[model samples]
Target: MPSIKRKVLVLIALLVVAFIAGIIFSPFLRETTYQLKNWVGKPSPLPPVSKTVILYFSTPKGELLSPVERKIPVKKEINDEIRMVIGELIKGPKTRSLFPTVPPETKIRAVYTKGDTIYVDFSPSIVKNHPGGTSGELITIYSIVNTLLENFPSYSKVQILVGGETINTLAGHIDIRGPFKKNPEMIEQSKILNR
Candidate 1:
């Protein structure tokens, strides 16, 4: 027995409620929204530019090596070059370890640069008895890259080798060949580990 105007009002109210529910719970709407956000496009280029990029490979034994190269400064961004990064990075302890399991004889002997490659030679003790894990491996990897990239700021890629040979594996898990871009994600992890 509702009046015509009252029925029309009731119908409008039901439609509005249904629309609100769809907005809150519809899966199709959610998928469309996320897809739009991801369409934002590629990563913007680094402003400061980068000098050398490190390449990481994994061996079943968990050993790491970085064979660096210097560029001719053709289209390079930072002027410091990879040698500066090596000098600075090597000057530090080289190992940002909290466990104290690393051997004392383990040391980085020299950092050499030629053209677009930088070579870092370390004492044999470095790979002597080091244990391996994802955290440890990435920490070591980022330690070198973060230090070098901070100094050179150009190049854009790196190749890592052991005693002058590029190994294919880190702890028999990760592949460390080709070119590896510096990982910004490591910055936060470094801070946490430092503290």
Candidate 2:
């Protein structure tokens, strides 16, 4: 039988070897052992390792604009702005005066969103003479539709209403009941890029 002192010496040697082996072969063991030592009983005071992730907003041009990007609330999408841009484009090459002629009384009431369809509401003045003839009206309406549908391709149809009332003709032509599809005529040189 070994003496108690000799047994103590043997146990100490084994513990030292285990400690060294753990340090060299597995760093995880040290962490587990430390945690176990602290959590033997009662509540464990140590905090768990965090694994949360956060995302930052960025433009297509790779410009970072997030917590540090704006003093005022920033819009993540430009669907409305893009649609307006198309409207300005429809007003003609010299579209700088488009806004002033919009008629303050004639304003967009609301835009109803549905699956692949958008219903845009405008004031009564929209039905007024919109400069161009049937072609002008076609160009105007289609410009808005095509631009919107392009900016948001997910949508397949668009409907325009005048002062909460659905008009039969934009300028004595073109049907307005059904949601209108994108107008191919408005698309520039390259209409639909397949690739």
Which has the greatest TM-score? Answer: 2
- What is the TM-score of each predicted model, taking all chains together? 0.43, 0.48
Candidate 1 at residue 85, lDDT? 45
Which runs in model 2 stand beyond 4 Å of their true positions? 1-106, 190-195
Q: Write the per-residue lDDT of candidate 2 for residues 1-195, one digit (tens) a residue.
A: 569889999999999999998779786877889899888867657653321211111112222111111111222344454335434332332222122223333556666667778878876666674543555455556655655675556789988888787888766777776789975544333222111
Q: Which candidate leads the pack in lDDT?
A: 2
Q: How many angstroms is residue 51 displaced in model 1 relative to the true structure, after the best TM-score fit?
A: 18
- Candidate 2: deviation at residue 138, Å? 1.0
CA lDDT, every prediction?
0.49, 0.53
